[model samples]
Target: MDKAIIVFSRKGLFQKTLSAFDIRSREHARKLWPLVSFDESRQMVTWVSPSFENGRLRRRAHFRVLPTQTSYNPKQHFDNQENHRWNTVKESTEHRLAKELITAEISRRLNYGLGMPWRFKDKDVSNFPFLGNLLLGADRVVRLCCTKI
Candidate 1:
């Protein structure tokens, strides 16, 4: 199975509720309408296809996970209704659980494999000169074309 690393979003708590929906919706929209056009009236691009008579795209199905299936304990965490002090134990527990949930959901839906531990090193810095030469060549070509125009 392929290996991967899971990184939590900076948005913290809100990411839990929104991330799954966002991913599914984006994937569904991409599959349903490979190309989208902007509507001047709405001032935004939509998933509606020109081939469809109604110019409407089907809604994406929502994914739900029961609380019993995962270690997530929503009651232990703070919410807008409760003004409880921040607890590191609760935060860490929830964070870890969230990661597990997201990783499992992504794996199940997208057919991704389990995550593996890995490390990164800055060994590629030596290749900078080669990249710089390629960029310089492209810049020269662009300059030549601009001058000709």
Candidate 2:
């Protein structure tokens, strides 16, 4: 699944730093919504506390966006496109397990996978694939627009 940054304002549960709930339209930005907050000391972003209950945090993994052939692919050690990208593991393991970060509207809207760029090397890291692989208690749901499902 793709990675997404869910801003959690420290002021309160509903309060947030960023007004709009958005990031790049890429796979990472769409699938995985790791609720997080900005880290001033490290000058980077960090994950926040998730309300998920379980002992399976390690089982959760990052969705590999882009294709294996593309430089933006997280699986590869590419040195480009670091402008808006941030390593979730590098920052902190705060909000890795979210209770219900993704909203119903976004999930339904993303089912089509329309904006996903075709993959030239490997399969695109869209929500369908990501959700299909969602852990038993990962708490996520996604539909595929390309398929009849």
Candidate 3:
């Protein structure tokens, strides 16, 4: 299986979006995280996984925004109104793309597991300090791990 680590800055869009969901519980927060990348030049947001293949580390793009789609720009209006409208459109577009990437990644993970049930084993929880709550109550762990994704 491939391994990946994604670190989102406190002020970044992903982090802010997660915060907006008001994930007060540790279990819920833990299950909502996804691995993704954004390419500025291509204006693409992609679901990616890093793996060791043939003795080399390779990054694979599982899902990505197409070039043609990324070129989207809001229609021009008056000077000030146009800039404001453009910013709004851009932010919304980015948010939508991020959500799509996360959804694709979650679906990929589920399919990759071949329909086996998700198990938050003790050992796995121990390795991740944020998941310590699982030790307190295994029953509290969210079964539908993709709820936020």
Better of 1 and 2 by lDDT: 2
Q: Give model 3's TM-score versus the native structure.
A: 0.19
RMSD of each: 24.0, 23.6, 21.3
Clashes of 2: 5
Question: What tens digits encode model 2's per-residue C-alpha lDDT throughout 69-100?
Answer: 22112323233334225342233334322322
lDDT of 3 at 137: 23
lDDT of 1 by residue, 1-149 (tens): 01111112354421322222333355554443212112112111223212233676454333222233323233443362254333322446666677677655644543333333344446666533322221221211111111111
Off by over 4 Å in 3: 1-91, 114-149
Root-mean-square deviation of Cα positions for candidate 3 versus the true structure, in angstroms: 21.3
Best by lDDT: 3
Q: Which model, 1 or 2, shows the larger TM-score?
A: 1
Worst 10 residues of 2 by lDDT: 41-50
Q: TM-scores across all candidates?
A: 0.17, 0.14, 0.19
Q: Point out the higher-scoring one by TM-score: 1 or 3.
A: 3
Candidates 2 and 3 compared: the better one by lDDT is 3
How many steric clashes does model 1 contain?
A: 0
- The whole-model lDDT of each prediction reads 0.32, 0.34, 0.40
| Top-down TM-score ranking | 3, 1, 2
